[model samples]
Target: MITMSPASSNINSTDLDYYCTETPTVAIIWCVLGVLCACVGIPASVWLLWVLVQRQRSGTSNDIYVVNLTVMDLFYNVGTAPSMINYIAFRNHAFVLLDEILYSFSAIGRPLFMTCMCMDCFMAVVYPITYMKMKRYRYRLLSCAAVWGITPCIGTINAFIWYSPIPGALYWLLVPTIAICDLAILYTLRKPDPSGRSDVHPQKQRALQTITNSFVMTLVCYLPLMAMGPFLRLMPASDQVKFCVISLLVYIAPLLGGIIMPLLQLHSLGRLRGLLYCTRDSGSSEQPDQQL
Candidate 1:
């Protein structure tokens, strides 16, 4: 939280020292609201994950990916969401740093895993046969392990760069990569079947549309958080303003992200939109292991 005192331009002009103090009444408002949001949002996400798992015991590839994303969101909100309160408490500096670590883990890990999820689904949609032959639980789990392990290391380094007040950009290069893959998958899915037998693959079209909707929602939610990167250092403002803005941004991104995924899982697929699962045979009760 940013301190709400009068603007301090006399302090080190290079660094705002954001997050070292709590903002005024607004900080209190945001903290209470953030805690309330987390309390309400986390359990809904849990129920959503359970719904995904119950819908398929062995779980489709998409189910696994969704479960992974839910876990990341839950961890983020539960672990780091209270940092707002901690900021208000103004306890030991060490505790503050610890929360930052937790924040970094969620922030870095979510996007890293999201990029993987997008790539995994893009492959499933754009090249189903090849993806199925190679997609196994072991391989998918390993990819998830890589994301969790790698992103935090990079995040720690970037955190240091920012804290050091170094002149640098904090963009996570994965954003554009994920966007391009999604656009490609969407294009490929919408392309006409050369054999003109599109009638046979109505299920594919529905799945692709649902997946596109998910990606578009995620992209929209991320813009508020990611758009702040370019201005992290360059955005000129009072220390109080910078702190308040950053604290709000840090929590707002997660609040939207944590809520959006479960909402997508539950509401994005209503009767009007068709079931999230698709089947080749009308009478078959079982669905294939891969989903968009």
Candidate 2:
């Protein structure tokens, strides 16, 4: 009589064979996208930071948040691409350890930085007085430090507990917070002044719009993982479903973030280009001050 232990069966059931025997089409696609993402994400992030350092000495509070998110994403884009290229060119010789290490950081770092951006918008719109008080670049720098400090703890949880669950928890926790903040700002914008001037302050309205856009990115990109968490992490799925889930987590999501970063800031690219060229701001003030 043959019998299988539950743990043994579970271990044996992992279809790693399918993972290794990839189709040529998938490899080519992954390689192309990986290189394109890295190409665009790396340069854009670097130039943005260069503009921050050279042009905006007294950068507004939002600039600080943008710096943090851009830096984290640069690390993510640079870190995730090489292994894929290597995988395509040299299969087993690919430095997969790079992928594992970089993915670990990007996995937590991306959303956390995004949360800080959303929270910065929340405060800027909902608590304008407090936001005004936070104008000093040094203060903003210190606050960014606090956000960056979260990486070790998240990395620890990922190392010990699980990686994907953190994003799920963050979605549940932060989505409502951001949504409430957006709604509150919209409410404030709609209310009339003492003279019955029911007009939204331009900056406040812009902030609200950016926050709303950020929420959309979060919802579209991250929410599905929350729903899939139980099945991917706990319950069993067929090989195809499992592959799709892992692919989304490891590949699609990061590429989306890299792509979406530029798109979200498409408005700012004009000002950014001006800064790059060492030219005076032709219309920086007229442009929207923040990105989703």
Best by TM-score: 1
Give lDDT per model, in order.
0.59, 0.56
**Candidate 1: tens digits of C-alpha lDDT, residues 1-292:** 2111112111243554444444555556666766776776688678777776776775442556667777777776686455666666754455555555555545566666777777877878888898889846777799888867775565445434334321112234666767777888788877888998757376675567556755765576555556654565576776556666554644465555656666666664452234434443433544343432
> Where is model 2 more than 4 Å wrong at Cα?
1-15, 18-28, 58-62, 90-95, 129-139, 156-164, 190-200, 231-237, 244-246, 249-251, 272-292
- State the displacement of the C-alpha of residue 9, model 1, in Å, after optimal TM-score superposition: 17
Q: Give the TM-score of candidate 2.
A: 0.69
Each prediction's RMSD over C-alphas, in Å, is: 9.5, 9.3
Q: How accurate is candidate 2 locally (lDDT)?
A: 0.56
Q: How many clashes in each structure? A: 1, 0
